[model samples]
Target: MNAIGKTAIGLVFALLLSPARAADINAGKSRAAACMGCHGSAGVSNSGLFPSLAGQSRTYLEAQLKHFRSGERVNATMNAMAKDLKDEEIQNLAAYYAGLPGKSAGGDAKLAAAGKEKAAMCMGCHGNELRGNGQFPKLAGQHPDYIARQLTDFKSGARKAGPMNPLAQSLSEDDIKALAEYAGSLH
Candidate 1:
């Protein structure tokens, strides 16, 4: 190629390979307006159908958003929402949600105890009270019904998770319920 042609191609490649801009938390809030309906006004859903997003780890949120966008996880609503999300938007959204405080779910004492036992093995990855770590999400304040749905979906291969997939397969329905209850009981 001629020098001018090479220069033009180099510029195109540079633009294509350029790193994404830093996430804008303010812009994320605006983008998240559409998510408030199901996820909650501040990331806590009033209904049990959706998982709360407030106080979840940014890393976890980012990973899940990428998964939804890539179809590694299946959820019609999330897939569509994430499909057009830019990389910076994902980072910003995660930051915005992670910065909020999370509320815990309510559960029966007996059931919570049982769930604690069930969740004991998960502490290493999920953190104390299953509040989550860098790449894991906080579950302490999530709704029991939502937790149950997620666990069931993971167990049934409907969600298609990496660690949760096989781990859930080893648990019975009752175990899943107990775990969800325990997680819900945590604040």
Candidate 2:
């Protein structure tokens, strides 16, 4: 090969071997300031209405954010908020939130007990502790109200979360309440 062709091949090899860019937590924290209104400080939602983002899987968070950005996951506020975010910003935000500690909402003992019985089915996807696995979002420390709301949405076809729709459809109102209580009570 000529000198120019050799140099081009060498550059391509170098580019292919280069390490992927890492997420910047500091930048993420700065970007997340706008999200704190409802997502809470440090990604922990103070209210039961919003789902806590702290300690969630980065992959799951990124996917959800992208879905919202693309209008695939329909949420009025999220779609609007995520619309302007760049790919790097989403990665950084997911990394920042995933590094924080998780917290759970306490619930009635009886309700939690009932929910625990049904939670076994959830273990397959969410893991034994309900901390989530792969693309699934963490449920261990989520708020009961948020959990119930999402489940209800899935059941009613208001939310379209793949397997969750059919699974939620199988749950009764009481089952949702019980499961939310149980899932929320987890640490």
Candidate 3:
């Protein structure tokens, strides 16, 4: 290609490939104050019922927030919280939470070991580390409450997806508990 065409293509490629720049941290911090009660001071999450938002991908976080707002991923608390947030606000929040470090919730050693066997079915998509990839949210070190809820949702058909719904349905309640316990133990 000619220099002019190449240059134009390069510019377009750069724009497309560049990481999304986060909004003002201070604004996000201020907005995040309300989130601290459940999500922890830096999005780590204090409650078992809530998933830790720390270190989650901004894209994933924003997408989930949008899902909650749209009722695609229904949760009363999240829906109410996310409904009023503007796109920018959601982006800012996502960026802020993504910047935090993740922590391990620690699980029963026995359960974690057994859970590993139970988790074999999950590894194909969730990764061997349970860190997940692309659209799949990381399951490693996730809250048991959150994992259990997702498993329940999958089993009950509240969270419908081709893979997860069937997988969840196949699992017994004990199996779900074992999987959650196992996932929460991984760093």
Candidate 4:
């Protein structure tokens, strides 16, 4: 290969090997100002109807935003919100949200314990701690109503094409309740 081509290839390798640049939290906070209404002051949604973003995995947030933007995940509000977001804004938003503290589900201890059995199914993807890895999302400390609604939506086909749909289809209402209660009780 030519010397110029080799140098260019070496530079590309160096770039690829370098750690990703740290996200700018200040920039993220600035961008997140627009998210405060439904997502609360720092991504902890005050309403049970909206899922909390605080302490969520950045990859999960990024994927969901992209999904909303691409029409794979369709929510009237989210679609609209995500449509105009640049990719960098999405990453910044994810970083900001992930840096904040998560809220509690506040379900009863017994119910949470019962739900732990149901949550076993979730362990495959959500991890043993239920905090989730990249792209799976944190179920720990999520709101009961939100979790139930999502499970119900998956069961009903309102939320389409996710692996959860099939799993949710197999869950009885009581199972859903127990799972939601359990997941919500986590820190």
Candidate 5:
């Protein structure tokens, strides 16, 4: 190949192969004190209504925070939480949360087992491990409170989604709780 062509190709290859830089975990932890009120110090939330942040993908966390900040994803609490955060702070928070270990679900065994069977319907998109795929949030090891709230939102039409709406509408309250317990038990 010609010298100019080779240089251009080399540059393109370099750009394509560049590794993505992750945010500093230590810096993230230092800045995460304010988040502990809800997310917990180790990222395992005691409150079920708030999602557990531990072990979540940093990319997903950053994206969601950005979305909330931009008003693309609307939640009064999230909006207020995200409003004043700078980009670096968001990245740090994501890094900190992603570094924490996930908690195990401590729900009832019989109910969780029954819920496992019900969760078959969710596996199509959430993955057999319940770790979730693109745009589908991970359910495994998540707080039951968050799961219950989301399920309620789906059923009430408060959370809108073409596919999820139909599925949620079909689920009874018992079914939702069972599935939430099952999902929490996954990891």
Candidate 6:
């Protein structure tokens, strides 16, 4: 390669590795205090009504927060909570939540086994481990009830996830339950 090409490549690498615009985890920690009421401490939820956020992809968290703030995703509480947040605050919160450890919701053996078969459809987007990619939210260790509810919303057109709407519409009620059980049980 030419010297100029080499120099450009080096600069690109440096930029990718640079911490410039990185989320301030300390700031996120304080900002997250207000979120604890429903999302629980460190982004782990204690109730089925909420989904845990610990160890989630930073990008996914950031996207969701932006969605809530923009009124693109329609959850009343999340909309209100995210409305006034600045972009930096959103980045910080996402970083903080993504740094925490995650836990599984443990499931019945039989139920998980049945759900495992159905969960194959999710592998393409959610990944083989169901841990998710940068663009998708991890399904492993999430609350089954929360997963089911989200799936139901997608299926019913109450929620507007791009590809999820059509995909979820194809799922039967039993399929949703089974997939949720299997996914939630994964660590």
Any residue pairs clashing in model 2, and if so which?
none
Q: Count the backbone clashes (under 3 Å) in each candidate.
A: 1, 0, 1, 0, 3, 0
How well does each candidate superpose onto the true structure, as a TM-score? 0.85, 0.91, 0.83, 0.91, 0.84, 0.89
**Native-vs-model 1 lDDT?**
0.89
- Which parts of model 2 have CA positions greater than 4 angstroms off? 1-16
Q: Give the residue spans of candidate 3 off by over 4 A.
A: 1-21
Q: Candidate 3: deviation at residue 67, Å?
A: 0.8
Residues 59-172, candidate 5: write the lDDT tens digits.
Answer: 788889998899877889889889888998899888888777787766767778988989989988877778766556678987666787898898999987668888999999
* Candidate number with the higher TM-score (2 or 3): 2
Q: List the candidates ranked by lDDT, beginning with the highest.
A: 2, 6, 1, 4, 3, 5
Leading candidate by lDDT: 2
lDDT for model 2 comes to: 0.92
Off by over 4 Å in 1: 1-22
lDDT of 6 by residue, 1-187 (tens): 9999999999999999998787999999999999999998968787789989998999999999999999998889999999999999999999999999988888767888889999888989998879988989998988888889999999999988789999999999989999999988996
Q: How would you encode candidate 2's per-residue C-alpha lDDT over 1-187 as one tens digit per residue?
A: 9999999999999999999899999999999999999988978787788899999999999999999999999889999999999999999999999999988778878999999999999999998889988799899888899999999999999999789999999999999999999989996
* lDDT score of residue 46 within candidate 5: 82
Give lDDT per model, in order: 0.89, 0.92, 0.83, 0.86, 0.82, 0.91
What lDDT does model 3 reach?
Answer: 0.83
* RMSD to truth, every model: 4.4, 2.5, 3.4, 1.8, 2.7, 3.6
Q: For model 4, name the residue pairs that clash.
A: none
Encode model 3's per-residue lDDT on 11-125: one tens digit a residue. Answer: 9999999997657667777899988888888777756788888877777888899999998888888899999899989888888877777888787778778889988789888
lDDT of 1 by residue, 1-187 (tens): 9999999999999999999677788988999999999999999887889999999998999999999999887889999999988888999999899888898778878988998988988888899879998987788988888899998998998877589899989999899888988988886
Q: What does the lDDT read for residue 28 in candidate 6?
A: 97
Angstrom error at residue 141, model 6: 0.7
- Model 2 TM-score (2 dp): 0.91
